[model samples]
Target: MSAGLLRNSFKGAASAAPFFPTLLDQIPNAIVIFEADSQQLVYVNPAAESALDLSRKSLEGHNFHDLFGDNLQLGEMIHEVKSGQAPAQRQELLLHSLPGSIHQETIPAHVVIALMDDSDLMLMEWFPIDQQLRTERDERVTQQVEANKELMRNLAHEIKNPLGGIRGAAQLLEFELPEKGLREYTQVIIKESDRLQTLVDRLLAPHRKAHVMEYFNVHEALERVRSLVLAEFPKGLKIVRNYDTSLPDILGDREQLIQAVLNIAHNAAQALSVEIEAGVAQIELRTRVARSVTIAKQRYKLALDLDVIDNGPGIPADIRERIFFPLVSGREGGSGLGLTLAQTFVQQHQGSIACDSKPGCTHFHIQIPYRRQEKSE
Candidate 1:
């Protein structure tokens, strides 16, 4: 129906009643209507059902305070709107579901509350705060990735010329050594120089490779990593595959994607050394389809959600935030470039990777859009 007609219906004209429920269901935001007299919910949209993580039948008879907990601010605002002290209002609230609810938790939301004209009913619409936070976090990660790329490229190039000179001089010195035993000193210099060169090469690797995009199954990449890791840790660790067979093929560099996941899974296995020895280490590769996701400031109708989970001692709290930064490592003798390179590869595909760690579980979540570039526009 037209905008004017919808507003008229909200103002107590009964003509819009029959189809308005459908309209509410179509809205992306969570919305619900409440009977003012009893403070009981009368209607709920699908989005509301999903956001509240409950069914309509379970939520419809619950009182406003019950669903929203005993939040004083929310209760006061609803009272003001229902009593006609305010025509409409909005507030950012930490809403909590009742203790008896299936999932009792605090929900951060920007909520709008208003009274229905000439009707003993109230309407509420809310945008989940966590969604906004995720978008903001994605933007920050994108910015950080760009900054890191520029820094690594410049630093690697600056060290490249001197590195070659150091190796060249060491080779000349090896020939001039008076005694054969003295040659060991020059050999040490040469070996160390080669090691440094390898490190620099890795630092510049992301830029050197061409981004060869193609359509491929993501499970192909995961399976490759799973095989490699299992081959390395054959005896103790178990690799579990939780695949959504219905997932569509994604467009990207399949090799780069494999390397990205391999880096993550390899690190997880390494961290599980103690568990591996005890024969209790586990790694899970889970995939699912995510809808209506915003990644790095762009919204995608569909995206690939992949998780790499390990049951190992979590990342050290001190270095968890800096795990993606170059040269920062939690393990002794670790090069610390794995996660950095993994993040770079994912970012190249217009995707983001994140980690959440605790004492027993460390989860690496990666998301990449499923739509092709041309269709993304």
Candidate 2:
């Protein structure tokens, strides 16, 4: 909100108290108002309650420092603003939580503190930096993935016709060859053409299939992938299921969801070659209901957070950023279409996939909103 707007809203402080609280609650960023002299929190917005993982009833009447712990930088900024050395103060700082709080981890936030006009209250607004960055990255990745899919679809179609003609000509020529030895050249061309045709078909597979939406347990899909991956690496790799059984059944294509998770798990299994040989490779299929998540610039009240975590060497840096791009692979002789197709399937379900990797740890996080189909439709 603009400073002038806030000033006008607080013109008659006593009469506007109720309305002001409702107005502040509507803001997306976390906001807290403190008594200047007492330094005790008097108002906490809904966003603040969610971000802090604490109820406003419990947060109010508590000293700011007692709740968020001591941060010298933030204190300095607040001091400057309160002392009139600055009209307002803004800084990016780590927002710490006290022990025994619901969430004890420090939050990276961009904070702004300002003194309310002609009042003994200081208003503070903060945006969670990590969450903001994740949302932005998800948006950018989704856009890039859509662009890549379109380009690949067009390219695949363009190559498909020529590929068929090449294979047809090779077969026709092979039948008329006078010498059996010369048949090898035609046979090589035919085989290569067939291979390219197969590649093109796989590239267009997701688009060609009709979306079959149905309500099903996400764990069922995970179980399918677990079985498939374990069957392939039964001896060395271990697949662990960490699921929240209370999660409601989500609506989507069961096969597509299964394939997406399978691709991720399969890639993880392949990357754990060394760990598998040592009998320590592990992959975890974890699921939880994410609250108030934003996917591709749209916020959802609840979404599925499906994570595929692997205890193996992380993805190589060279191909990590473009892992979802078709034809980009880190492993030798790899088709590189696994992740691309997986991303496509998830995107079709109005979701996004994110990957984080470092040595000995890799996480593939997939989020899809839960929306029940209209009964009237």
Candidate 3:
């Protein structure tokens, strides 16, 4: 909100007596008023304390410049407002709080500086931009997953019937062949048709599973995947587990969870084949719990956070966005249905999986909400 706009809102706030502070506390954006001569904060609302990671009492007598002087750009902006160089101005800044507060990291924010009319005091408002951008990106990815679901259903149906007919005809012709050489030709057609049939069945597999819900430990699923991966690549790859044992059991299908996690681990293993040969391949399975989280635009009080991190040559940029699609594969002989199936399973449990990759690191984050079965009173 503009300084003038907030000033106007506070015009009759005194009439409300005890509720005046409450009104200022409710504003989401941080608001701070500074004295021109002393260069110290004169009034700071509750929101300012939260956004700046400093309590109002702690900030009351501290010079604004002293607290934020390390940021040269922000200092210049403050000087501009103090000298009345402009009526009001806005700029994006990287802000870090003083050493006193719990938050010690820098945050990107859009800052607004405005002077209160006929007063030496100026109001500076801080608004963080990270969460806003993340929310928008999440919405877009979720919509894309929904659209993919519809396409998979229609595409699978279109291929299944013709695939079965071709396979049946090839089988009938093989039975009628009189000589071994002629039978070999029929065998080729039958074998190829059967292969295509198996591919079609995989495409239809997600919808075929029964979602048998039960309270199951997420670590159990992780362990099952780890054991399977080790069994496949014993000599080269090393699987590390970092699990939070205190996390609550998730309401989900146990076998499906295993398949979902295995696809990701399996993909990572394939990507690290070269590194595995060199004895440098490593994958980590990490689990944690996040509170008051939002997934696919839905809010949950508690959610399970699973990270499958790999030390491999990251996903190729060309097919990164298309990696979750049914037939898109990065590997030479890969069917490319692994990640698609993984996504389908997680989404069925009202969850989301996000992937971030670079040259040395590739991380897939799977977030599923914790929905516990209530105990009998």
What's the candidate order when arranged by decreasing TM-score? 2, 1, 3
Off by over 4 Å in 3: 1-91, 95-107, 110-130, 373-377
For residues 1-377, could you state the per-residue lDDT of candidate 2 as single tens digits?
A: 33333333333343446566777867778888776777777677666766776666566447778767778998898899989999899889898875556447888889999998645778889988788677777678777877888998999999999889999999999999999999999999999998998899999999899999999989888888998988889898989988989999999999999999999999999999999999999999988766565677777767888999999999999888999999999899899999999999998898988898999999999989998798663
Clashing pairs in 1: none
Candidate closest to the true structure, highest TM-score: 2
Minimal lDDT window, size 10, model 1? 1-10
Candidate 1 vs 3: which has more TM-score: 1
lDDT of 3 at 312: 99
Query: Model 2: what TM-score?
Result: 0.77
Minimum summed lDDT over a 10-residue window in model 3 is located at: 1-10
Winner on lDDT (1 vs 2)? 2
* C-alpha lDDT of all candidate models, in order: 0.83, 0.84, 0.79
| Tens-place lDDT digits, model 3, residues 162-235 | 87898789788888877768988877877887887788789888888778889988898899999999999997
**What pairs collide in candidate 3?**
none
Give the TM-scores of the predictions, in the order they appear: 0.76, 0.77, 0.71
Question: Which residues of candidate 2, in runs, are more than 4 Å off?
Answer: 1-70, 74-91, 96-106, 112-125, 130-137
